[model samples]
Target: MATRKVKRLYRSDVRQARRLLRGHTRKTPVFHTDILGPRGPVPVTLKLEYLQHGGTFKVRGCLNALLQTRGDKTGVVLASAGNAGIAAALASALRGMSCTVVVPESASHTKVAAMWSHGAEVLWHGTTYAEAHKYARQLAAERGAMPLHAYDLPEIVTGAGVVGLEIEEQVRGRPPVLVAVGGGGLVAGVAVALGLRGRVIGVEPEGAPTLHAALAAGHPVDVDVSSVASDALGANRIGDIAMEVAQRYGVRSLLVSDDAIVMAREYLWREFRIVVEPAGATAVAAIQSGAYVPAPGERPVIVLCGANTDLATL
Candidate 1:
């Protein structure tokens, strides 16, 4: 199997992202969170991407990759904790291509069910997304399938950049900070989109601080995975491309706790009727737990990136 070519994100990539996601994704509402704010009611905006197709922002990248490989009937293979698998499956089904997804044992049943519903073959392996990814790569080589990485590929970053572009358009005025990070794709693309407009804060679960660890060591390095948000934000190491974009663009990384994620999840659901998974709520968790504090009257935008959790578990 050929090694996939990974490209660095740029201004042009952001432009393409907007064009690709124009009609597919919801211009998800950005609303204030009154429940978790400063003493003077610090206004916050939530980019509700949970309403996005395939139940997360993963669809944007998945569809972008499919568009690039339109003539490849050999199909594609991927491994995801949940959201990416569902997105890939849905995109492949819509494009009339075959897809096989390897998912970790820890993947939520709801996500696995959604993938199967989209007519993709689902394989369960190992105990985490990274391990499943290894197996998926092997399988793709055996099957002559193109491998689509969840967060490390250029097309994926370009597609995810749409989120940042949408946020800029939706917010009207400049926001002080945009908070989000996971495997570095979302935040890296977003950082490029912001592009000197505002600061981008990359929030990682304390248990799995891949980007944080990378920053500290001055290079990408493996980190332990033990966070509640591990499934979604659980890349052991940041991608070289993502790290390059992040460093070049001046993105900052912060750590947030699992308890904070739980609180943010419940807070959003209780206040705004928005249900998000642990990984999706990490940005909001940063603000809610005071891990990321905004300056006086500084408006911050928190991306609610996914909603793939089982409601029953909530």
Candidate 2:
């Protein structure tokens, strides 16, 4: 019922999004690596999305939306926990447009700096992301600027689906993919990319179970947010498009604890010398913490999605 008015995204839409992206976004690489499993070294693929421009896959969606709305000179206004705002700012700059981002006071100072570096007018609005998002909507209306939703808009999800499309070309088989979920845009885009035959698992932090709660309620619903990964995956509710995709494809949801997220982030650094934010490590956390055990002869792909964090904290 909560998803009734949501627009459905097709695989075709993802393809169109890809076309819109053109030379704007990066085709981030996937590294085939093995993690030490319970039995032995378990093979796993890591989609190194942190290497993407703006240090996250959120740039893909932002570029897609901005490019599609190329003629609009009013610019863009959006709210993000962090990464989405940076993405929107950078993408808007790429399009020769201005960006104004309203971020919660709790947003990462590092990510806020990144947005400023991209020429975004960063404003601190509230204590939480929801409150900032509300103010951003009102601000956008007043300025007649394009309002961007971090994970709700079809362009955002479809642009992210291009990652899946790349995966299909790069990976050998239809291995299961574990993608971190905030408001469900990335996972829904992945589902469209992998199609019916491919398996896509949505991973969330237990402290911020937006998609998990939405799936359980059979509609989008708000949930309280608290997690180390909350800065990136802190959406209070899953978007309607994401909810529709979940129902249409029966996309399963899983939750990982904040401890698992932190450990996984550290593990990637220790083992691979790669750095990611807590939200980026969540998909791997599901495997590391035993939330989703890989099947025999199964090598899952974990999408490491963000790196917009303070190095001093890491």
Candidate 3:
């Protein structure tokens, strides 16, 4: 069988997106802390992507894809579990384009409202992300609108790779990066940016291990999804581009329980006054639960990627 030609997102691609998004996106700084460095005196750096425009790292990819592909009067369509929908809506609004977002019934109400607030025509579809994705594609086809993928598209992942570039330049010691995986876009992009220089740990909720299952199967495979983080980290299957990047770069996948996720979220609030959604707390959950322990002297960097949560619940 002939091997499929996978278009890789190189470091140059990431740099290009970073340059393009300079004036539009926020350059979130690293917050150094000793809270998770409990194993010893090692420092822990948190890349506060939750402070980004549209309140998540999803904005980076959404904006980049729209910026690169949008034409005058171009309409866009996308399916998201939650955060990606809001990002797409915000990106479209910024670019002065019309957007329609199809979201799963399981999506958070706050996220759906945010998408609507950004001038997107929001539609409720199936109960899972995969189902919504199928309907979204059909809607795009019917309406002759440009279809935007939540994670699989090269432009999106390439934009996400910019986060890794920022992390490398912003952090003092170029520490290992720990990121939560949903459809695996963020980790794959980070893998491309960091390459072999630093370890990229891909964290996931125990209830929804899409990347983990894919890595175990040696390919992208559908998995059952259910967890506190499902609204954000609930892709039925890992994206092909993401799997290729992860395997090529030797990105490590780790899983943490939902309880650990709650604990991590609470810890962030207690220590840093940071309010993060469940998916945003997955990386910290791995450390807090010892799922991915830092070495004696290794400095681990965690990317808190979203804040579009119902703060009242927290």
Candidate 4:
């Protein structure tokens, strides 16, 4: 058997992204609270990352990738389910570069409108995101533009890792962190930053089990996406970087039911008066559903990763 070459993410890379991201992102606030566990009450911290610009953390990666294109005077192209497209468009607009976004026809109307509002030339491709991604790459090649990926890029993953660095400084004691997993970008980056200090748990909707599927298969495998959190966490397969990072750093995985995701989203509104989309609340769902039972000594941090929900749906 031969070992595969796995590209690793480094803390130094995270620091560089942090340097590049200065003045471009917000240090989203965190709230401390306790949740009931089977043993007793377990302390938990909620990282309100949904308040990030563009109402999602996608802006960090998009901005970092855009800023890195220093001398290359080229347009940008993107294929996103929702938030990433909006982030790419906004970043390009801020940099005064042209951007084109290709999205699935099934994407949220509000999300599509947001990309257009951010000055992206939005195009509707096929219904599935895979279809849109292929088309977006073709268009990028045709225009000689840079293609900004939602995940699976060193720049994008490193930018997302900055979130973990921020968490470490804001909260003491190297707490176990729970982050929602979509394409494995955010969790992978966070794991690289956190290292072995504490456990990094990736939570996902049972319907969209990309990380779980990859871990089980020992490689990235396409899975069916049909979760309430699908719009944000609907990467059909986890990226190679995420799978490798998980294997190297011992990142844990948890699956929560779709019903639990809905309930958790509602609970955030009723109990904490916090507004977040389904994907944002998915990490909390692990706790609320008892899918992840915290040890008495473990204080887990839940990252609310997105807030691009249509109020009508809420």
Candidate 5:
């Protein structure tokens, strides 16, 4: 496996990245809310990233990586559960680079179709994202293609930090917590951007507690992969870089039930008119299930990460 020392992104890195993404991605809204307030006395702000380009915040990092690798039209290859593939394909299309995406057999058809629509060659591999990633690496090496890791690169993390940067500016003051966790990229980036400014509580599906398992083992360790949010949050193990950044920033991880994710999805659609995949709603699950209580009068922020879901399921 490839290994590299990953640095925590500074405020200047995020500031420079924003300039790079000016016309490409939106500064998604951070809406202060009381909608889920009946359950607790704390106010909440939802960072609506589902509204971002390519239907998720993945575009920020995808575009950043592509831009950094500019002048290489030989194209890039990547593996993703869904959203990352869509983001990479869209970025490739915009840059006129040939792109291929390896996705797990378990990925939603809607996401697969979106990749095709963006002119990306989609290859289905094993039953999970990790398997697809393994194959993608082999294919990239064989084709002399650049590999764009979904969560393990510094550029990707720096790009994702933009979400926290936008939220910090939009929210005015620090929220008590910002909830999100996956293969650890999103939370890691957000934590770095929000470090010492506020607390960031990471929420993962109990079925796919990559970060939790990593923390317990004192390093990135592979965990069982079974979760409704598996397509998006599922990684056999947390990325080594993400783990380092997250641990250094004091990020705490929490687990939520699959039932909570379903309810969170429904809540977002019914109340806020937002459609999100299970992973995207994980942060909301933390709030809905009372997994993390807010301090009185303190604000809580949930990063609504993505919305690439099959409409029929909604």
Candidate 6:
């Protein structure tokens, strides 16, 4: 007899993760606004995840992974673009665990510095995240460290899904969520949590359109990754978990140009005094550029995912 496998992230799992992460992570607040939609001024909500610990939502997943580690677990190794590495390193530091983070040469100095500040041994590997990831996997196997993927693993995704649970609790009626997509873990987790209650719209930079390519091909596939937001939003391919959830839940994908992303970042600062990185502002870019138009009388919600950036750049 075939046994039915449990889902990687059930509602109960997400709830438990939220409880476990309560003190470790912040319950980021949502801000409401009226944006000019296709029809007229439409109500909108912004999830200020940039204010989250480690300056990004990645901390939730990292802390969850750290908390779930067994006594026998010795060390952690992972490849990251930036935020995930910083979050993982921070979590490892809090747990007194040894951690190593490998990142592409293209990773931001500000983010790498943050990771180091948290006491993680950091290595600069290849030119792109994909290249760094390959090396990290090999190193982890050789060192016997627990391999951590930024967005692919079930536990990581389940941890990230806690964001969705918080959103539903903060805003009743399950408003459509606009999420910035990199490797797609955040959106996938959100989709799993929200299910039929809300719609998940994934926004990617046009320059690094991994999920866009995957959606067009009807499966995850390699794509050339480059963008102003690439350091934060770059992934060579969409994860299998993300693709499965997207397909099952009908998650829609959208793209915004680098120009739009820059404008959105500036707009956020100018209008709301929010300093967000290019990747963090990608979801807002979709709305500001009309790449994503809200339905009449529909109040959409955008997840402002990260704020890890060189303030000098801002």
Winner by TM-score: 2
Rank by lDDT (best first)? 2, 3, 4, 6, 5, 1
Give the poorly placed runs of model 5, Cα more than 4 Å off: 1-4, 37-42, 70-73
lDDT of each: 0.80, 0.89, 0.88, 0.87, 0.82, 0.86
TM-score of 1: 0.93
- Poorest 10 consecutive residues of model 6 by lDDT? 1-10
Cα lDDT of model 2 by residue, 1-314, tens digit: 55569877888999999988878888889899887644567789999989999999999998998877855566899999899999999998988889999999999899999999999999999998899999999999999899999998989999999999988888888899999999888999999877788789999999999888987888888899989998999899988888888778778999998988888888899999899999899999888888888988888989999998888777
lDDT, candidate 1, residue 142?
91
Q: Which lDDT tens digits does candidate 4 get at residues 1-314?
A: 00256567788888899999999999899999976544556689999899999998888988888888966766999888998998889889989999898888888888888888988898999987888899999999988899878888888899999999999998988888999999998999999988877579999999999888888877788999999888888789887888888888888889999999998898888878888999999998898888998776777899999888888776
Deviation of model 2 at 311, angstroms: 1.0
**Per-residue lDDT tens digits of candidate 5, residues 74-124?**
788999988889999999998778889999888888889999999999999
> TM-score, each model?
0.93, 0.97, 0.96, 0.95, 0.95, 0.95
Best by lDDT: 2
- Stretches off by above 4 angstroms in model 1 are 1-6, 38-40
Tens-digit lDDT string for candidate 1 (185-207): 78877877777666788898899
Off by over 4 Å in 4: 1-6, 35-42
TM-score of 3: 0.96
The TM-score obtained by model 2 is: 0.97
Clashes of each: 0, 0, 0, 0, 0, 0
CA displacement after TM-score superposition, residue 87 of candidate 4 (Å): 1.0
Model 6 has how many clashing residue pairs?
0
